[model samples]
Target: MRKFSLYMASICLLFGCEETIDVELKDAPPAYVVDAWINDKMETQVIQLSLTQPYFDSSEPTPITGATVTVTSEGKTFSFTESQSGSYTWDPATSTDRIETVGSRYTLTVNVDGNEFMAESELRRVPPVDSIKFTFKEERNAFQPEGYYAEFLATDPVGPGDTYWIKAIKNGIPLNNPFDLNIAYDAGFNEGGNIDGVVFIQPIQDAVTPLNEDLDEIVPYKLGDSLHVEIHSITHEAFTFLQQVQIQTQRDGGFDEIFAEPLENVSSNIMMMNENPDVQVIGFFNVSSVSGRGRKLTE
Candidate 1:
């Protein structure tokens, strides 16, 4: 009986144990990522190119080198030279004739290896920021005490569909987070809002206040801190893309997980001109007329 029991125990140990299974995840093909922007300043227009990395990659995206980039505007063609790794820049200082003006249409063409991509944007004018105001609020979150919140006093153009991308610069550092991304359509929160030809509404004005990334709460300003506000006139397409990006960032992981929208890629203006339809291009190209105002905190 002991020998029979030992034999059954040996069989159970050999067959009933957990086994590790190896998962072979197929590698996704790389896609070209283009982060290209042009403002009314037009000193040195830049376009950055890189290849998308895998989902689990913690490192920066791989930059694509040795590409031909060109921009055409006002019946003239301007070529860009590689100033750094995967970055192409066109300096108008070398030739004063290559200025980017409002209402001018600019076209970008890129050729890398055998793949080609093209995009076009028209510069739109933005309303000047008359002034900026701030208010101190009592403790709203347990993480921190009272903080300063900023608001803009600018009138929207008397036209419908006038979209904008508002950026905050605190002490020379740009507040670049999903929460800091403030976009308004026709002086309202978004396209659905009918407010126009007036000062920005309360919600739109309050959205520009900077927030702490680590604590995920509104950050108060210190004495002598400089706050600069920049407003960029952007296309409706660009506004939609940024809105989607904000939604994606906010829905990453929270109580709203069940109400999150379906995952979708950020729309890009660049189109593949090559015959290979399988090759994909990502990111956006934007041309904006920027207006800015700055103030320092005294109290």
Candidate 2:
């Protein structure tokens, strides 16, 4: 069992949140896997490089070491040194300046093992979470307990296509199950509506609550429960990738699986710099701007 789910942990290279999910590969030959994404928060940023392994060989993904990784924005380049196996880091502790800025374009360059890959992303803006509030549900259904349920209040900026990944953190842990993953378009889900510049819609807002371990039931917060909500502004491409992932990785079993579409690879933004068109890389790179709020559920 890996630490967490979503493309973020396995991919922390996924959303790069220091959590990882269990992913099993099929009978394909090994390919380079780049789990790289970054944020505008002033902290140590990371990019992970690895190689895909056998489906049954579930120790850990083999690390791709000794790679030169750098991110350049507005002509200034920040180098990431390999801090550990396959994981590279750029610490801003020495300097007060952060690497990325909102609306600025960023370029990623990776050179290793006679292969070079390049990618580009823009640091997008995020709407701030005004507050987190919880309400006590007096009725206990078969689905959930009679306790406090939490939701955050924050309006999407007055614009279209403002995609966001809403992370619901309870206590000290992230509710990062594959089913727990929640993303929004504008102020809602993909319903083909112009729902911008408003607080997040019901389903999207309600997703802050997580499901049980089996992913079969909802778990509400209780008295004294700590609730933290974060909005990670992602690219439209990253949004689409997550959309596909949530669809593909959903745990709906039985008849659902029978009628499900054949599994295929999700998309990636990382690509080879040279014309070695045969090599396939998996993963994405997005420069995100995050906004958040936190508090506890009290009586």
Among the numbered candidates, top lDDT falls to 2
User: What is the lDDT, from 0 to 100, of the residue 134 in candidate 1?
Assistant: 80
Clashes of each: 0, 9
lDDT of 2 at 9: 37
Query: Top model by TM-score, which number?
Result: 2
For candidate 1, lDDT tens digit of each residue in 1-299? 65775466555556785444343546789999999877766467889999987766889889999999988888778788899999998887787565447788888899998898999888887989889888888886665469777777889989788989988888999988777788889888887789889988877777667767663566778778888988998888888888888877754464345457866677899999978866899888888998999999896
Tens digit per residue, CA lDDT, model 2, 1-299: 33334323334443535543455655877889988888877788999999987757778899999999999887687899999999999888865557556889888999988899988888888998998878888757778777778888889899798888889889989987899889998998963878989988888888898888877668888787898898998989989989999988875775356467767788999989777766777889988898888998776
The list of candidate 1 runs beyond 4 A from truth reads 1-25, 140-144
Summing lDDT over every window of 10 consecutive residues in candidate 2, give the lowest-scoring window: 1-10
Clash pairs, model 1 backbone = none
The C-alpha RMSD of each candidate to the native structure, in angstroms, is 8.5, 9.5
TM-score of each: 0.86, 0.88
